[model samples]
Target chain A: MSLGEFDLIARHFTRPARRSPLGVGDDCALIAPAPGMQLAVSSDMLVEGRHFLSTVAPERLGHKALAVNLSDLAACGAKPLAYTLALALPRADDTFLAGLARGLHALADRHDLDLVGGDTTAGPLNLCLTIFGEVPTGAALLRSGARPGDELWVSHPLGEDEPGWLGDARLALEVFRGTPGLRVPGEAFDHLRLAMECPEPRVALGLALRGVASSAIDVSDGLLGDLQHVLRRSGPDGRPLGVVLDADALPRSPLMRAQTAALQHECLLAGGDDYELLFTAAPADHGAVRAAGQRSATGVRCIGRITAESGTTVHDRHGHRVATPWASFDHFRS
Target chain B: MSLGEFDLIARHFTRPARRSPLGVGDDCALIAPAPGMQLAVSSDMLVEGRHFLSTVAPERLGHKALAVNLSDLAACGAKPLAYTLALALPRADDTFLAGLARGLHALADRHDLDLVGGDTTAGPLNLCLTIFGEVPTGAALLRSGARPGDELWVSHPLGEDEPGWLGDARLALEVFRGTPGLRVPGEAFDHLRLAMECPEPRVALGLALRGVASSAIDVSDGLLGDLQHVLRRSGPDGRPLGVVLDADALPRSPLMRAQTAALQHECLLAGGDDYELLFTAAPADHGAVRAAGQRSATGVRCIGRITAESGTTVHDRHGHRVATPWASFDHFRS
Candidate 1:
C-alpha cells in the first residue's frame, strides 16, 4: 500500500500517548515529569552499513535503534518515559516499515514507553532515536562519581562467547549466513548473533542500582573505552584514575574462547557495540549491588577495580601483563 | 589536529551544562523543569543532498538543522530549554566542524538553549536535533483547539511574493548566484535568501499568544497542508472546519512578482520550509493577537477564518475562484 508521510506516521509510528499529555500528531509531545524528578534525555543515530548490515532484519534494526538510546538512560539509572524517532529512509517500503514498527513497538510497549513525536524524511536510511526518561532529582549515577578502590561491576559478561551478550554479532550471522556454500557451526552462533543484534537495555537494572552504584556508563565503545569515561570523570584526587581488569575475572564468552587469548582480550576490552552496563560501587555495597541485580532480574559480576594510577591495563590474577591496551574505537582514529 | 570521536565531541559539541543538572559526558542529560510545567519535545533530521545542496555552507546547514526543530517548539508555545544533537559525519573535517559548531552555538546562545547531550559517529553527514521546551501544563497551544468561530491568524503572510516569509527561497538565491557566472538581482535577493536560510522561529510571538490563541502550528509544511491539520483536529461538532484563504491578503514579496501567478500561489500554499506560525484565536482575542505580533516584532496578518463547513478553499477578495490545494510536502508524495 502507498503511504504518504502522514499516513506512514499514523500507520506505523503513531500511538496514543497514554503516559504523556499529548503525542504523535502534535507539534510537540507534552511530558509531565513527576514532581522532584529530573528528565534524562539522550540520542543515538544508527546508519546503514556503518551500524548494521544491509540484510539485517528490519525488526532487529528497530529494536537496536531504540535499545541503544535506552541503554544511555539505563546508564544514568533513569526510568524510561518516552522517545521520538527521526527517520531518514531511502524509500518507504511497507515490508521493511512493518518489521521495523513491529520491533520498535514490541520493545517500547514492553517498557511502557510512548512513541511521542518524530520526523520522517527521504534519504539514505539513518535512524535516530532520542529517548526521555526520569530519575529522582540528583540521584542519577554519573561517570564522575566513582572513587579509587571502587569495585567495577558489569551487568553481564562481554564478547561473543556469551551468545546472550552478542547482540551486535547478529549482523555477522547475517553476513555469514549468506556466504557461498560456506560451512560453519550455525547453531553455535545463533544465540550470540541474536544477542548482538537485539541486546536488551539494562533499564531495570540501572534503576535498581541507583543510590547503590557510585558511577555508571553503558558499554557502547567497548568495555575499556567506556570505562575510560568513568575514570576520566571520577579520577581520584584530581588525577585520572586507571582501571585494572583481571584477565580471569573477565566475563567468559564461549565464542570468545574459540578465538586466541589476544583476540579474546581485544574483543572484550575494546570491541564496542556491547550494550551492557559497566558501573562502580563501594566495596561495602557489594551485597546491595547483588541484591539490586536480583531485584532487577539482571546479572551482576565484579570484574575489576578503579585504580589511582593513570591508564588502563589487563593482568592475570598473579599480576602478569596479558597485553597492552590501545585506544578503543574512534570515529576519526586516524 | 588529528581528532578522535571523543575529541571531536569535546572540541565542538561539549559545553558546560549551565541550565541542565547534568550534561554531555553523562549517559543522559538531567533537566529539572520549573514546577507546574510540562516538557514539550520534538526532533528533526536533515540529510545532505536531500535537505541541502553540496554548496550550502556548513554554518547555514547547522543553523537550519536546529532551526527547524525550534520552529515546532514555537508552534506549541514552549520555552526553549535544551537540545541533543546526534551528528553523523563521513569524516572528521576540522573546518566543517568548526563552522557547524559556530552556527549551532550562535543561534543556541541567542535562544539560551544548552546543548545538553548527544552522540557523534562516523557516517554520511546526517544531523538530528531533538529540542526540549517547557509550557505550563494544560496551557500548551495545540492544533486541535480551534473553534469554528475562531479567526485564523498567521504570524506572517504566505506565498512567494512575501520574501519576508519565504525561507526556502534562500536556496534559490544560492542557485542563481552559482549559475555559471550568470548575474541576477544579487542585493535584492540577499534578505530573502538569508531569511529563508536562517529563519527566526516565532518563539516570542508564540509565547505571547499562548493563552490568547486557541490553536496553533508552525508552518513547516506549506500553509494549506499545515492548516489542514488544524481543520482536521479542530473541527466543529463532527465535521472538519473549513478554511478560506484570501489570495489578495497573502503577504507579498518583490521576488515573488517575478514568478507567474500560478507559481506564486503554488509557492505560497504548498511550498514547505516556511518557519512561520499559523494560529487561530477567538474573534474577541484579536487585540491580544495584535499585541503578540507587536511584542514579537514580527508581522501579523489576518488571512482567513475557520468555518463550520468542511475542507479548504482559496478565493480572491471578490469571491472569484483561485485554486485547489492538495497535500503539502510529503517525503514520498511522488
Candidate 2:
C-alpha cells in the first residue's frame, strides 16, 4: 500500500508512550527527568555504504542504528529513557519500513524506550537518532576520570565468544570481500554475520559500573585507537597519561586463533563496530569491577594499566616492544 | 589545512557549555530542566536536493537547518535550551565547514543555545538537528487545545512583508527556475532569496503567545494544509473541527499582487518554507492576542474562525466559496 509520510509514521512508529508526556504527534515531545536526576543526550548519524553495507537487511540496519547510539549512553553510565529518530529514505517502501520499524521497536520495547518526536523525508537513506537517558546527579562516568595508577578493563573479551566479542565483524567483512587464503565453516560464518549485523549495547554493564569504574568509553573505532581517547582525556594534573597494553594478554577465540597473525592483529587491535565497553578502574576496585561485569552477565578482561609515561605502547609475549602501525577508522580519512 | 573528523569538530562545533553540565567532548551531554519545567524535544532532517537546492550557499543552508528546528519549539512555545547536530558530508571541505559553522553559531549565540554532543561522518550531505527547549509544566501550547468559535490568527501578514512573507520562497524558486512570463525586480528578488534561505523562527512571538493562543502550529507546509492538522487534532471531543478563512483577508505584497491569480493562489495557499506561526485564540482574548503580537514586535492578522462543522473551506471577499485544490509540500508524494 502507498502511504504518505504521516500515514507511514502512524502505522509504524507511533505508539503509546509510557514515560514521556508526549510522543510522535506533537510539535515537540515533552520529557522530564525525575527528581535529583540529569538527562544524558547523544546523537548519531549513520550513512549508507560508509556505515553499513548495501547488502545489510533493513531490520538489522534499524537495530544497529539505535544500538550504536545506545552504546554512547552506555559509555556515560546512563539508563535509557526515550529516543527520537529522524529518518531520510529515497522512497517509502512498505516491506523495508515494516522490517525497520519492527527491529527498532523490538529493541525499544526491550529497553522501555519511547519513540518521541522526529521528522521523516525523502532523500538518500540515512538515520539520525538522538537518544535521551538519565543518571543521578554527579554520578555519570567520563573518559577524563581515569588515573595513572588505575587498571584498564574491557567489558567483553577482545576476541572470544560468538555472542559478544570483538573482531567478528571484521572477519565477516573480510569474508564478504573474499579475501584470499581465508576459509570458514558455514555455521561459524553465520555467527560472524550475526555479530557484524547486530551489536548488543552494554547498558547493564555501564549502569553497574557507575560507581565502580573510574572512566569508560565504548569501542567503536578499534580497541587501541579508543584507548588513545581515554589516555588523552585522563590527565589528572595537566600531564597526559599513558598505557602499556599486554598484547599477549588479549583474548582470542578458536577461530580467531586459527587466523594468520597479521589478520588476528588487525582484527583485534584495529577493527571497528565492536560496541564493547573499554573502561578503567582503580587498582583497589578491581574486585568490584569484576563483580560488576558478573552482575551484568558480561565478561571483564584486564589487559593493561594506566601509566605516568606520555605515550601508549604495547609489548609482545617475549617482553619486547611491538612495532605497531595500525590506525583506527576515521570516517573522513578512511 | 586538512583536518580529521575530531579536529574538524573541535575547530568548528565545539564550544563551552554555558548551562549544560557537559558539552561536545563527552560521550553524552548532560542537561536538566529547572524545577517545574519539562524539556521539549524535536528533530528535523534536511537532505540536499530534496529539502534544499544545490545552489544554496553553505552558510544559508546551516542557518535554515537550525531555523526549521527552532520553529518547532516556537510552535510549542518552548524556550530554546540547546541542540545536538548530526551531520553527514561527502567530504570535509574546509571552506564549507567554516561557512556552515559561522552561520550555525551566529543563530545559536542569538538564542543562547548550547552546542552539545553530536556525531559527524562522511556521506551524502545531510543535516539532522535535535533541539531541546523548556516550558513550565502544563504551560506549553499544543495543537489539541482549540475550541469552536476561537479566532484563527497568523504571526505575520500572509504575504505582505518582504522580510517574512509566506510566498517569497515559492517566488524565489520560480525565479530561479526561469518560469516564463515571470518578472521580479532585482532588489525584490534578492529579498526573496534571503527569505527563502534564512527564515527567522518566531520564538519571541510564540513565547508571547503562551496562554493567549488556544492552539498553534507553524506555517511550514502551506497555510490550508497546516490548518487541517490543527483541525484534525484540536477537537476536544473527537469530533473534528473546521475553519472559515476569508480569501480577501489573506494579505499580499505589491510584488505578489502583480502575479497571475493562479500563481498567487498557489504561492499563498500551498507554498512551503514559511516559518510563520498560525494560532487560534478565544474571541474574548482577541485583544490579548493582539497585545502579544505587539509585545513581540511581530504582526498578527485575524483571517479565519474555527467552526464546529468538520471540514475546512475558504470564502472570497463576496462570500463565494473558493475551491482549493492546492496541497501542501509532502516529501514522499511530491
Candidate 3:
C-alpha cells in the first residue's frame, strides 16, 4: 500500500518513549542533561550503494545506521539518550519505510533512547542518525589517552566469521534463510538471522570500562584499520600502539570454522563493519577488566600493548609480518 | 581527477576551526559552552529536487542548508556555536564540494560558528545540517509559551522580493549563472544574492527576545502555517491566542510595496523561506519591543495580537476572510 511520511511515522515510529519532554515532531528537541553530565553527540551517514549492498534488507540497513552511531557513544562511555534521524528515501513505499522504521524503533527501545527531532525528504536512500549521550564531565573516554605502557585490548576477538569459514554457498544460504539444508533447527536459524541482521550496542561493556580505560574507539573499519586511527590520534603525551594478535587467540563460532580456510586471517583483518570496542588501559586495570567481563558475559580480549614507536604491526602466530591493513570501504573510491 | 573519500575529507573538511576544541578529524567534536549556558541543537535536511532545483548554485544550496538549521536555534533564542553537516552527494567532484564548503564556511565565519564534525557519503544529493547553540537554561524561548493578549511580531518585512523570489525559474537561473538580467549594482546584487543564497541567522534578535517573547518560531514554512504550529503547541496553562493581521502593520520594503501591486496578498501570507523570526510577546512588552527594534536597525513589527480563541483568523485590508492557506512544498509530491 502507498504510504505518506506521517503514516509511516505513526505506524513504525509511534512509541511510548517518544513522549520524552524533547521528542519527535518539533522544530528542535529540547534537552536537559542530568546535572554534572556533559552531552556527547555523534552523527553517521549510510548511503545507498556506497555503505551497503543493494541486496541487503532495508531493516538491516536501518539497524546498522543507528547501531554504528550508538557504538560511537558507547566508545565514549556515554549512555544513549536520544537520536535524530534524517532519512532521504527514494520512494514513499509503506512496506519499505515501515520495515526500516521498525528496525530503528526496536533498536532505540532496546537502548532506552528516545527518538527526538529530525527531517525526512525525498532522495536515494540516505540515513543520517545523529545521537546524543550523556557522560559525566571529564569522564568521557577519548582516543587520545593511550599511554605508552598501556595494554591494548579488543572487546572481542577480531574476524569471527571469515568468508572461507561459512560452508558451501547453497548450504550457507539455506542456514541463513531458515531452510533445513543440514537439518539445523528453525530456532537456531532464527538466532543466526538475528545475529546477522541486528547487533546489540555494547553499552554495558563500554560503561564498565569507563574509568579504567585510557583510550577507546569502536572498530568500524575493521580491527587493524580502526586501531591505526586510535594510534594516529593518540595525544602528545600518549604513544603509538602496536597490536599483536595471537592467531590462536581469535574467536569464532562453529559455523565460522567450517567453511573454506585459505586466507581467512587476511579476510578477517581486512573486512569491516564489526562494531566492537578497541581500547587501551593501564596494566593495573587488567584485573578489573577481566572481573567485569565475567559479570557482563561480554567478550574481552587483550590483543597487544601500546608502544613508543609510531606505527602498527600485526604479527602472525609465528610472529612474522603480515600484509598491511587495506583501507576500508571509501565512498569516493574510483 | 577521481578522489577517495579520505582525501576529500583531508582536503575539504579538515580546515582548522577557531571555535572547535577538537575538529573534523575526530570521532566526535568537543565544544564547551560558555559557562552556565545550555546547548540548543537542531537539524534540517535539503533534498535536491525538494529544496532547490538541480541547477541551483551548489554554493547557495550549501549555505541554505546550514542557514535553515541555524534558524531553528535562533527561534529558540540561542547563540550559534557549531554545526555538523552530513552530505550525501551523487559524486565527489572536488569543485562542487569545495564551492559548497566555501558557502557554508563563509556564513559560519560570519556567525562565528565552527564547522565541527559530520559524515560524507555518496548517494542522491541530500544535505543534512545539524547545528548547536547555547542559551542559559530557563531563558530559551519555546513554541509553547504564547498566551492570550500577547502581541505577534515578525523580524523582517512581511513580503520578501516576490518577483525575484528563489523559485522563479528565470531569477534562479540568472542568479546561478551570474547573468546580468534584472540586475542592480554589485553591492545591491550582493545583498540580494545573500538573501537568495545565504540569509543571515537571526541569533542576536533571538537572544535579545529571550525573556520578552512568550513564544517564537522561525518562519521557514509560510508565516500563517508556521504560526499555526506555535499556536497548536501552546502549553496547558497558556491562554488561547487569536492573531489578527493588520495588512497595514506589516513591515515592507520599497521594492516589496512595488511588487505587491502585481503579486497578490496571498504571496505575503504564503511565500515560504523568509528565515525570519515570528514571535509573540505580552502586550505589556510592545513598547520595549519597539525600542529594541529601533536600536537594532532591524524590522520587528506588531503584525497581530493573540486573543482567547481556539483557532486563527486572517483579515483582508477591508476585513474580508482570506482563503485558507495551502500546504508548503511537500517533498514527496510527484
Enumerate the candidates' DockQ scores in order: 0.59, 0.61, 0.39
Query: For model 3, what is the error of residue B328's alpha carbon versus the real structure, in angstroms, after optimal superposition?
Result: 9.6
Candidate 1 lDDT score at position B225:
74
Give candidate 1 misplaced runs (Cα > 4 Å). A1-5, A157-162, A166-184, A236-238, A325-334, B1-5, B157-163, B166-184, B236-238, B325-334
Range of the 10 consecutive residues with the lowest summed lDDT in candidate 2 chain A:
A325-334
lDDT (10s digit) by residue, model 2, range A17-37? 999988888789999999899
Clashes of each: 18, 0, 3
After superposition, the stretches of candidate 3 with alpha carbons farther than 4 Å from their true spots are: A1-4, A7-21, A53-59, A157-196, A235-241, A261-263, A324-334, B1-3, B17-21, B34-36, B157-194, B235-242, B260-262, B324-334
lDDT of 3 by residue, B1-334 (tens): 1236568756876678787555565556666666677677788888877777786677787778888988899898888888888877777888888888888887888789888788877778788888888888778788888887889998863246422232222233344667543333444444455555556557778877878888898877567767776776673444334567765565544434444332434445655667778899998999877766666555687888777775667666688766544533222111
Off by over 4 Å in 2: A1-3, A157-161, A236-239, A328-334, B1-3, B157-162, B328-334
Query: Candidates' TM-scores?
Result: 0.92, 0.95, 0.84
Per-residue accuracy of model 1 over A205-243 as CA lDDT, tens digit each = 999999999999998877776777788778755567778
Best model per DockQ:
2
Docking class of 1: medium
For B72-117, candidate 1 gives per-residue lDDT tens digits of 9999999999999998888888889888998899899989999998
